[model samples]
Target: MEDVNPRIAGHYDELAELWDDIVASPSRERLLWETFEGLLPDLEGKRVLDAGCGSGFYAARYVERGAEVTGIDLSADMLERAREQVPDAEFVQADLTQPLDFLDDDGIDVICCQHAFSHLEDLSVPLSEFARVLVDGGVLVVSTHNPVHDYVVVREGEYPTETMPGDMEATVETESATPVYDETERYDIVWNSGPDSNRATYYRRSIEGLFSPVLDAGFEIRDVVEPTPDEAFTRENPEIAAGFKQDAAKSVCLKAVR
Candidate 1:
C-alpha cells in the first residue's frame, strides 16, 4: 500500500490546535461519541489501542474507564497534544496503513479507530493489522463517513465542497458522483472552524466495500450503527438536527469482534 501519512499528517498539523473545537461541534462529535460509546465492551483492565488518536480525546475516555490505553497517529503535532491531554496513556506517531510493529500479536483487547479510515486508500492493510494485534474475541470499533450520505451530498450539492489542497493530492479515483454505489472515490472534505477552513482528502466507499475487508480479515461483524442526533443536539440546533434525521446518516459506526 502507498504511504499517504506525510500528507495526512500535514493536513492535521494545521488543524491540531483547533481539533477540539472542530469535533466539539454538536453535529459531529456529540453524535459520534454517543454512538461509539454504546458499542464499547467492558474496558476495565483491558489493553486498548486508540488508532488515529487525534489529541487523545477518546484515549482519555478509555483511560477513565480503567483501560490501559495506547494511542497512535500519523501527526506528530497531534500526538504531542494527545500526550498533554492524556498523560497516563502512551502515545506514538505511527501510520495505520503499515504494520503495527510496536504491538504484539493478540495483545490488544480493543481497537478504536474513529473517523480515520477515510484518509486511507485501502482498508485491507489496516484491518489485517488490527486483526493481528487484537486478541481473539477482542472488540473493534470504527466510525467513518457514510457512503450513502456522501452520495446524497454530492448528488444534491446541498453541502459545501472544497478543492483538494495544492500540496495534498488524492491517491484514489476522484469522482463527484458514481453511477453505482460500489465504486469507491476520493473527495475533498472541508471543515470550517470559525472563519478558517481546513481541507482534507477522504475516500468514500459503499457499505459493502467498507465492511468486506473487515470480514475478509477474519472479523465477525457485530453491530452497524447509523447515528442520529439526540435530544441535546436537537435542542441546540433544531434545524440541523431535523436535517440530520431526515437525510441520510452523516456517519456509520461499526462494532466487530476478532
Candidate 2:
C-alpha cells in the first residue's frame, strides 16, 4: 500500500521549474488564489476534473471559468507545465494512485483536487475514482494538508517526531532516499523541498484522516474551509500571518457532493 509513485515522481520531477515559480508568486502565494477562488462552483459549462493537476495550477483557473477542463497529472514534468498552462485544457498523463480508466461512468462535472489531497498513498483509491467519474450532483474540490496545521511544525525539530520505527534514510541532495513512513505509519511526512535537495512526501490525514474517506467514497459534505491570511495576505506575510494565527489550519478546504 506504499507505492508512493517513484518517490512522488522524483519529488515533483525536481520541483518542476520551482513549482511554477511558487505558483506564480503573489509574495510567495499567500491568498492561495484568493483562497482557491472561494471554493469554486459556477464554472460556466462545468465538466471540470483537474484532479492533482499540479502545474496547471487549478487547471488554468478552470479554463478561465468556462470549465470543460481536464488536466490530470503525476508529473510528466508536471504534465509539461500542465500543457503550457491549460492550452484549451485536456492534458492527461494520469495516476492519482491509479484506476481512472480515462474517465466515463457519470463523466464528471467538477473535481478540483488542489494541493493534491495530501499526496495520497490511499484515499480509497482516489475517493473511489471520484465516485466513478462524478455527475450525480458532482462537486469535489478537496485541497489538503492541515492535519493540525500541516503536521505540527513549530521550528527546528527536523521532522520524525514519532513515526519512524523501521525504514529510514532521508538525506536528499546528499542522496539517501526511502521515505514514505515507517513506525506503523503515523501518517507520513518526509521533507526537503525549499533549498533544492528536493526530497518530498506528503500524507498526514486525521480529521478522520480527512473526511472519512470522503464519507466512504460517496461524498456529500458540502463545505469546510479553514483557510485564512486575507487582508492582502496579512500585509504580504506578517510573519506568515503571525504563524497563521498561531497554527493549526495551514489549509483545509473541502466541499464534496457527488
Candidate 3:
C-alpha cells in the first residue's frame, strides 16, 4: 500500500499548475473528456461522480452536460485548482485507496476516473467497493496509463536519466527514505528531468490486470478504448500517429457495469 495521501497530495500540489501541460494538451484533454462522456449511458440530469478528478478537466465537461457531478481526489491542492477551474461543481478531497467515504451504496449513476485507476496497488478492495457504491447496472469508467509509451520516451530535463526498458511491463518499487511517509512507491518517469528519479508510488496496470480483478470485483467489462488522434490525425502523420498507436502504451478506458 502506498501512503495514499498527503505525499501524493503534496506532489500534485508541487506540479498543480503544470500538471496538464506535462500530461497532455487541451485538445487531447477534450478528446479524452468526450471519450469518457460517450461511455456513460446518458448525460443529462444524471448523478455523476468524478473519482480522482484532477483539476476538474473532465468534471467541468460533465457539469456542462447537466450532470450532478462531485469531484473527489486525494489532493486538496488538486481540488482547490479544480474549484477555481470549475466553480459550479462540488469538490471533495479524499483518498481512493480504501473505500470512498462520502458516497453511499447504490447512489451514483456513473463514475469517471480519468488517468486515475491504474495507480492503485490493491485493486481488489477498491474495485469491489466501487461496485458497492454504484447503483445496479450503473457504469464505472476507468482510464489507465497505457504502459508501453507512458513508460518509454525519455525527454531531457524531465528526469534523472534516460533508459528505456526493453520489456513493456513496469516494476513497482518504494522509497527507502526513512519512515517512508505514506509507503508511497515510485515509477520511473520515462521522460523526466530528475535524474534517477521516479514518479512516487503509483502502479501502472496491464491488460490482464484491467479485466481479471474487474470480473473478480463483480463487474462486467463492456469496452476497452485506446484514445488516439482518430483517423484524421492518423492520416496527417501516419508514421508518427501510427508510432503512437503502435505502443498501445498511452491510455486505456474501461467501462464496467455492476
Give me the candidate number with maximum lDDT.
Answer: 1
Tell me the whole-model lDDT of each prediction, alpha carbons only.
Answer: 0.81, 0.69, 0.65
lDDT of candidate 3 over 35-138, digit per residue (tens):
76577777688888888888886788788888998988887777888999889889998777777867899888888888776567667877877888889989
> Which residue runs of candidate 1 sit more than 4 Å off their true CA positions?
1-3, 156-180, 190-198
* Index of the highest-TM-score prediction: 1
Model 1 residue 147 CA deviation (Å) reads 1.3
Better of 1 and 3 by lDDT: 1
Clashing pairs in 1: none
Candidate 1 lDDT over residue span 66-158, tens digit each:
999999999888999999999999999888878989899999999999999888878999999999999999999999988798666555544
For candidate 3, the per-residue lDDT at 240 reads: 45
Candidate 3 has its poorest 10 consecutive residues by lDDT at 154-163
TM-scores for every candidate against the unseen true structure? 0.87, 0.31, 0.76
Ranking by lDDT: 1, 2, 3
